[model samples]
Target: MKLITLLPILLCLFTVAAKAQDNNGSNPQEKKVLKLINALPEIIASNKLRMKKDPQRLLKAYIEFTPTAKDKYYQVSVCDDFADRLFAYYRFKVNAATYAIFYDDFENGKLVPLKVWQKHAYGIYSKR
Candidate 1:
């Protein structure tokens, strides 16, 4: 009787463990992209980076990620409007398990870094 009851409990535990391992088995590149997305708020707050549109408001915007030729870098494009007129591009870099984010704005047909943040051992650092 006790064994029958514990069988269901053990099966549940195994199911949960399998799900956890499945999540952990996700692609490393995807995980890094997710980490960049999740760190936006903290990075903005820590660096006092200013944006034309409110970051929270921009959360409703359409976002796309493009991987760079370099393995550890990516280009993130965010469109704040349904018409896609208002858009911005950002560069995200991963170094030594740390992340660095940069705003890339085009001027005179050349991309320029407007703001920058690099994750440090203690905290995030701004390199504006």
Candidate 2:
């Protein structure tokens, strides 16, 4: 009888866990990546930079910019190099499947991290 009662409880817990996973991808890392990718282009534009209609691959960039003429915190994601246009905006010399996030407020314009964005995106990532 105890096993019968425990079975239902286990199933319920499993269902809740599955739903959570559905809401957030099997790997939270991927979700974080998408969130970052979705906000790249606008950030670039807001910085007084112009970008082509597309990126090297797939990106849905956004930004949190001010109307005044001053640079602020920004985050960007570069999905791929399919269109060969990601670097056209930042004027950065990055390859593909990488992120070229720049922080105008960090270290007097020194591009930190240099790389390693894929392994530890969260370390440098910040959501709106």
Worst 10 residues of 2 by lDDT: 87-96
The window of 10 residues in a row where model 1 has the poorest summed lDDT is 17-26
Superposition TM-score, candidate 1 onto the true structure: 0.33
Residue-wise C-alpha lDDT for candidate 1, range 67-118, written one tens digit per residue: 5455444444433333535543333333313445554433323333324333
How would you encode candidate 2's per-residue C-alpha lDDT over 7-64 as one tens digit per residue?
9999998778433212122344445544554445444444332245444333333222
**True lDDT of residue 71, candidate 2:** 35
For model 1, the stretches where C-alpha displacement exceeds 4 angstroms are 1-26, 42-65, 68-72, 80-98, 108-128
